[model samples]
Target: MTDYKLGRDYARQQDQNDPLKTYRNQFHIPKDEDGEDAVYMTGNSLGLQPKITATYVNEELESWAKLGVEGHVEGKHPWLHYHEFLTDTMADIVGAKPSEVVVMNTLTANLHFMMVSFYQPTKERYKILIESDAFPSDKYAVESQLRHHGFDDQEGLILWQPREGEELLRYEDLEAILEDQGEHIALVLIGGVNYYTGQFFNLKRITDLGHKYGCMVGFDCAHGAGNVPLNLHQSGADFAVWCTYKYLNSGPGSLAGCFVHERHGNSPELNRFTGWWSHNKKTRFNMRGAFDMLPGAEGWQLSNPPILSMAAIRASLDVFKDVGFEILVQKSKKLTGYFEFLLKDLGEDVIRIITPENPEERGCQLSIQVKNADKTLHDKLTKSGVISDWREPDVIRCAPTPLYNTFEDVYELVERLKKILNG
Candidate 1:
């Protein structure tokens, strides 16, 4: 078992030595009824707002008030090309070329847009594959796509399921399924990190397997985008989509990011749903001519975005640019490892961690399965000022976000759990 001292004083000492502890002050940590900062462990659901967020957003609001129509091109951060300013940094976060990434629409909306271009199912190979426990939005999106193509959703959808009585998915089982149904599978859409189990799937391995079978692969990276090092370009996926509201620490319902591999950047022949914003910016106002699509992921955009939402995303991306994903990921492994160590010390029978045993196989979030416990156990934790999320059945999800969460946070959380479970 890993060693972690179990006292409050030790927890405080860990925080004092934490490299990323200062980042906590940068966000407006949520408060309780008494106005104390809650433990705030649910960054996986909605991140705390960075204090700078308002400043970034106000700048845009000011430009709009002053310049009106001309703000599109004349504002300090011009509305006409505001999205461009975010490209390089966002690309670095997901490990993609600037041409391959675009920040646009919400998570599910971007998923549908990517499907329009990549999920080209034919009669011979029209089936879609995904994890059985995938987020509901993703399952619905894929099912709807199969229905749109005139195929029976039941027949066209294949599930890569975990072993019976097992909480985690197995790669060997996935390989077996692909070998059996490779010819009929059209696309493989998976969560890069499962929201429920917190399992970070191997993107490159899955991409390689899908391509070997002549299948197009895509990922829903809502839980993985900022929590893990995606390396989307090197993974060689046909497409990917993610929300920024979670680990990226943007505001609630912020703009999502989409990526298309560089090989398909200039393929006008590829099917897509488009809008005026996706038209070639150089000649967008010359509207009387043919529809000239912008290359890469930008071509998939369906409308002009809400600049206010983009402003929040811009503020968060600036933080990411400053920290660098490499440094953040390094911290993540240690912080999460510390969390796992403390939790496991509580004894396996009372608390079972459902996420993968291997640190390399998951992100910072730990989904704890409290034995025979109910929502009341979660309530007690909340009453004690621990801010964790309770998923249905019996799991409580706590994420020690590397950008802000310190080792002390994790240590206190586990100590609190021990007190609760012992009672």
Candidate 2:
């Protein structure tokens, strides 16, 4: 293990030797009331805007001003094929083939759309499985799917819950649930990373188990996307969806990504909700013959996308392209590990880190339960110019994102928490 120690000087020294320090200047770190850079640690919620985002978005505005309707065919990036430009790069990010990935609607919308084709339930097999404490939106999406199929929403949802007093869900419990009720389940939809607990699930193992039971498996990777090496294709899940606004550094509410394994990319039997955009490019405008479906994930599109939002994604992805996903992940592990080391030094009696200690099972986020602390602790942290989020009851989530957060940021956050708790 690398030698880690206490004190601000040590943190500053680590930042000095950090190879990725140069990229920090590329983002806008928020300023406190007194005008110093705040210890911003919320990349898990929304990533900071890249400095070049404005320039990229402005290009689309300029093109629209000059070309009007002709921008579809005449603009530099060309609106008609704009989504195509992001296909290869995004596919690379999520470890999927070009034909299997698409940038489309927002996260929940894409989840609903994907369920339209993937979550086909029958009279005997109508149950869906998910973690007990899934993100609210994902829980809502799955529950609605059960009700839409004319099943008892409560009875049709199977929760793979944590043991009696523990906080993390066990895969063994999941195995037992499937062992007893596998045949009754039609879909296995899980969050690739548990948003609150910061636990990254074993996607391949979950996929294999679900498939063994004759179920279609999918993941909502909102927390796992830019934070971990998903290798979604290698995992063999039937489908997956993720939002770009978090670790992707894309703007808020930006377009989400969808992936369909190549095995399903060309399958014509699956029922889908389609529109004009889903038509094959060659015949999309022919307007005379039978509806011709595109041969891959591109077939999921229902409308031409908003160009301005896409420009922001393009700009942020260019930053990722320059640094490479591997490089970002390598730095992420080291930075977050150092943060963990320092927190442990504070003594576990006063604080408990609920996020897994093993780096492989989590991303950058650390979910801390300050003994008996509450939201006031989070408010105090914010007032100290440290931007951290607090979940209800007693947990504070701090994510030391590798892209821009420094070792000093982590040090300052703990120092602030220490002062508040000890005082």
Candidate 3:
């Protein structure tokens, strides 16, 4: 544990020593009324824009203006194989092999597509399992999947809820559920990092248990992708999906990523929704040829790459590449740990941090519950120049992204909140 102090000078001193300190300048931090940079702590919801994003986006615009139709084959970065450019870096970020990863579609879209292939449900093993507090979108998607398969959504859905009165999930509880209904469950889809509590689950442990009982396992890594080091391939999950707009610093509603374990890459028997993009590149343009599926995650692609969105993703990825992911994760632990340290000083009677105390079990986000406070508290913080996410009723989610947030930012956020709580 870090020996955290209670003053602003300490925070600035830590920032001065931070190797990643200069990166804060690379992003365009939101401005306050005085035109000063706001203490932007909502990277988990939407990351700040990188200053260079426009340059990359405009390159694609120039290509379209100059080369027109020929841009697909003749541009600086050809649109024909544009998605391929993101493969290696994204694979490295998520700890998967290049062949097993691809950037495509939106988060829920990828999840549904992955389910089409992995959620092979028999009449007996037709149920799907997810956390009780899963992101509403994930819950809705899974419920719809059950309904689409002609099963009663309510009966087919199994929730691995936390024990009564507890906020974080216990592994033993998950084990117990799997032991009881493993055979009946065809799919175990979990958020790699639970959005509500910022709890990072043990993916490998869950995957192993699910596989033990003949269940296909997958993860919605929307909150984990750039915020934490998710070793997706090592987790032995059948499939995984994540969005790029949050910790990835990509533009809003940008394309997402998908991972298929290398083991299933060549499984031609697996059912999937396919398009010409999934066909063999050589034969893709040869209209007369029969459908030939490309092996690996690329085979999941349903349409040609969207270059403009991809360019923004590429730009953000370049920033990640410049600062290696390992280094980013190292900085994340320190920043969040420091944030936790300061919040704890605010007194447990007044402040409660529901996120795991262990740095390994979370990313940079800390979900805070101000005792006896409501949404008005969140609104006050916003007015005080602290841009954060407010979960209904009481929780305030603050993520001090390692890429651009400083120790001072974390310090100021807590101090501002402390001031509000005091009054």
Candidate 4:
């Protein structure tokens, strides 16, 4: 067991020495009525905006006002290829080659676009597998795809469920489903990180299992994108989609990122819904020929994207570029470990952490399950200036983001939780 005082003191000391600690000042930390910074642990929902975001957006707006239509080419950020500027930095963060990644539509939209190419279902092999508790949007997208293919969703869909009374899904269970239904399953679509339970699934292992069963595998990484290290290239999945609004800190409802494995990059035969943007860049504006798709993920784009949203992503990515994911993840492990350490000390009888205990199995978000206490406890914590998320029934999610959250932030949050629980 770690010494409580030592842990508390060490947390404070770590904040003092932290290289990324100064980044907290770069964001506008929310405050309570008393003028104190609210713990701000909801980065998992909507990340705090970087101060430079407005500046980045305003520059584009200024160019629009001054140059009018010429802003498409003459703006400080050329609107024509604005999305291209973000590709390299985003590819680095998601662990994909530049050609494999593209910034495009919102999360659900990208998922649909990916499905157009990857979720090809045939007569015998037509079933799609997904987590039983997948986010509502994903469930809807898959169901719609099934309907579009002339198959009843209930018949064409397969759900990999957790064991009775369990909050997290097991790989063994997933394997069992694949073994029993492997013959009929055509695709495996999974959430890279469970939004509610904060469980980080092993992507490579899942991909391997699905491939063994002759299934196409894809991932919806809304919660996992910036939260966990998703080596999409190494994971060998056919495709993946994720949003930037959460851990990527690209503001609310930002453009999403999609990855298409290099193996399929040049496969012109692969089917996808296309538009002018997906045509060859050299002759894109020629506007007089058949649709020749661009190679890799860029080929998936259906239309020109919103430049304002891309600007927010650019600003946030610049910060990530400066610090690097390696350093951010290192601090994340420690900060979240401390949060877990302190929560465990509160005793499991009163408050149970639903998230996995292993650091490698999760990012920084911790889902706390409070016994006998309902949302009231969450309300109390909020009143005390701790800004955490509350799910229905009884779960409070607190994400100690490494870019801004300090060790002291974790310590203080736990202390507040303990006081609320004891009272």
Candidate 5:
């Protein structure tokens, strides 16, 4: 909405004015056959690697080689408390207290772990609610949870689907579902940002509505974490989980994050799966002390962390810290807005964007639905030095990630698409 113009010069000017432009050098942008930078628009799927990631990972390797088992306590950034290294910055990224957030298992694994304590179901309130178009992993996880608890998966799972002929979900629809069946719903788990439509949900509103009906609320912030200002603590949900690879710029398949509201930090009554890492740190090495769980999100740790993955996370977070999240978000809105503007100029009849147009309603990603297009169009774009994501059927997801993607990248992408369409 910044009165975006219709030329490559405009994109270059915006990039020149971008304060976060230099930060792009900190990442290793992929290149095309001609050695030019590829327009990477899939940060929502897997973020680009930080240039310093190798250095950080190597340091851990050196520590392991030099200190052996002593590395647990003696290495630089000691393995004994490696996960703690990420706590503060990660807390700031997701807008949660350090004690409430922890970097641990994979996304789905963390979701299941969180559900073990938060999704306790009785005979009556056993149903779980999720978006109808939720990531397949989440759907599978919830269905398994229902089956494990002796409930009929098909009957117990409630989907908050968009109305016919619509793409974005409505908050009113969610409220109606909760109002009509809230009594039977034990948990309400939603993706913080819908992956396909890129619609950022109102977390606080959802949490309030779910809590009002006596349902435990949580969010799978896999797509929201670094892409948007989640403000998880302010959302007042019981818990949330996210993977660090997407948007977080941690290495692919790296550690994920979990957040348990501070209210449940020391709730002894809550049942959780605990292990050695969850025990009191002071006596953790004693090996004979009773299982006195650590308070807050730390108590959920099931085992020691992978230091290599933590190192990669540390590298990426350092970049986020130096740049400051606010500046990145500011750039994100402008970058995506410009992308939207360019796409809209392509003619609404020729292209459709399913992602919310409101700047506050989405992250950097725009899910484009091209008219009379298929995967071959996406293939052509790739051959034209654009790397993007193709959803099944017809949609293409492109995220102009603020940390690295530029206005020129967005502009060039549309040009390639326009060329292909015209040809």
Candidate 6:
């Protein structure tokens, strides 16, 4: 590991040496009281807007205005097949084949859609497994799924919780749960990265354990899609879903993405909800044509998508393409580690980090547990020009996004936090 140092000069030096530092200019960083860029660190919540997003979005508006209804066939980026353009790039982000990936509805909507196909529960085996601390949206969706199938929501759900006095979920505990109740589990759905703790699960290991118990395995990768490399295909998960708004830097509430392993994609036997878009494009408009479902993840779509939202995604993804994902990951590790190092210097008496310390086991986010602190601390930090977010109770979620965040940003954040705590 490279030796780290304290002080503002060290941070500036690191920024000067950073090859990706120039990328910070491409984003619209929120302004401070002095009209300068704030020490923004909430990419995990919603990424900053890329400078080109407006340009890209405007292109669609112009096409719609000029081409009118013909935009479906004649406009730029043709609305008829617009979603197809995002397929390859999105697949690359989540490490799946184009056939296995599709950009569609919002996150929870896609989760319910995928569950309709993957979470089939028989009388003997009709339970779903998830981490006890999954995002609230995920918990609600799965509970509804369980209730929808005439199962007791609480009785049909199994929580793989952490050990007493521990914050991170242990793989051993999950293995034990599968050993005992895997026979009754119809589905194993988990967050690829825990939103609160920032622990990145071993996707392949979870899938293997679930499959060993004859369960359909899947993941909610809302935080992992653009933050980390999720080899969804090799992980052997039956399906996965994620949003584009956070780390992907797509505009707020942009369409989500879905991944069905190639094994399931080509299998026409799977039960799924479908619509006109799900029909084969060759005869989609025939109206009287037989329902020949388009093979793969695209078959799960239920309606035509909004092109304006997609344009924003395309704009953000283009920036990711320019920087290359692997390089971004490398920068992310270093930036996050530097932020961790600084936090450690603040002393355990003052703060604690709930996220995993290992770079390989977590993304850029580090959940800080400031001792005896409350939402008031978070408010102070925000008032002082640090754009970090607060979770319930006492944790602060600050993420140094590699695409644009600089070492100086991390340094200044800690300095500001220190000042606020002392004040």
- How far does residue 154 in candidate 1 sit from its true spot (Å)? 1.1
Candidate 3 Cα lDDT to native = 0.93
Q: How would the candidate models be sorted by lDDT, starting from the highest?
A: 5, 3, 6, 2, 4, 1
- For model 4, residues 297-365, the per-residue Cα lDDT tens digits are 899888988999999999999999988988998889888887887787788887789899888899999
- Model 3, 123-212: lDDT tens digits are 999999999999999999999999999999999999999989889999898889999999899999999999989999999999998999
Q: Which residue ranges in model 5 land beyond 4 Å of their true spot? A: none
Cα misplacement distance, residue 277 of candidate 6 (Å) = 0.6
- The list of candidate 4 runs beyond 4 A from truth reads 1-8
**lDDT tens readout by residue for model 5, 19-98:** 98898899999999999999999999999999999999999999999999999999989999999999999999999999
TM-score of each: 0.97, 0.99, 0.99, 0.97, 0.99, 0.99
Question: What does candidate 2's lDDT look like per residue over 1-423, in tens digits?
Answer: 678888999999989998889989999999998999999999999999999999999999999999999999999999999998888888888888999999999999999999999999999999999999899999999999999989998999999999998888889999999999999999999999999999999999999999999999999999998889899999999999999999998989999999999999888899999988999998787888787889889998999899999999998888888888898888888888988988888899988999888888999999999887888889988999999888976889999999899999999999988999887
lDDT of 6 by residue, 240-353 (tens): 999999999997788899999988886777888889999999999999978889888988888889999999999988898888889899999999999999999999999899
* Model 6 misplaced stretches (Cα beyond 4 Å): none
Q: Which 10 consecutive positions of candidate 5 have the poorest summed lDDT?
A: 1-10
**Total clashing pairs for each candidate:** 0, 0, 0, 0, 0, 0
Could you report the Cα RMSD, in angstroms, for every candidate shown? Answer: 1.4, 0.9, 0.7, 1.4, 0.7, 0.8
Instruction: In model 5, state the lDDT of residue 210.
Output: 98
The prediction achieving the highest lDDT against the true structure is 5
- lDDT score, residue 175, model 3? 88
Clash pairs detected, candidate 3: none
**136: Cα error in model 3, Å:** 0.7
Q: Candidate 6 — what's its lDDT?
A: 0.93
Q: Please give, for residues 1-423, the per-residue lDDT of candidate 1 as tens digits.
A: 335666678668877876767878888887776997777799899988989999999999999999998999999999988888889999998889999999999999999989898899888999999999999999999999999999999999999999989989999999999999999999999999999999999999999999999999999999988889899999999999999999887788899999999988889888888899889989998889888889887877768788999999999988888878888888888788888877877888878999998888999899999888999999999998899999998899999898877777787777777888777
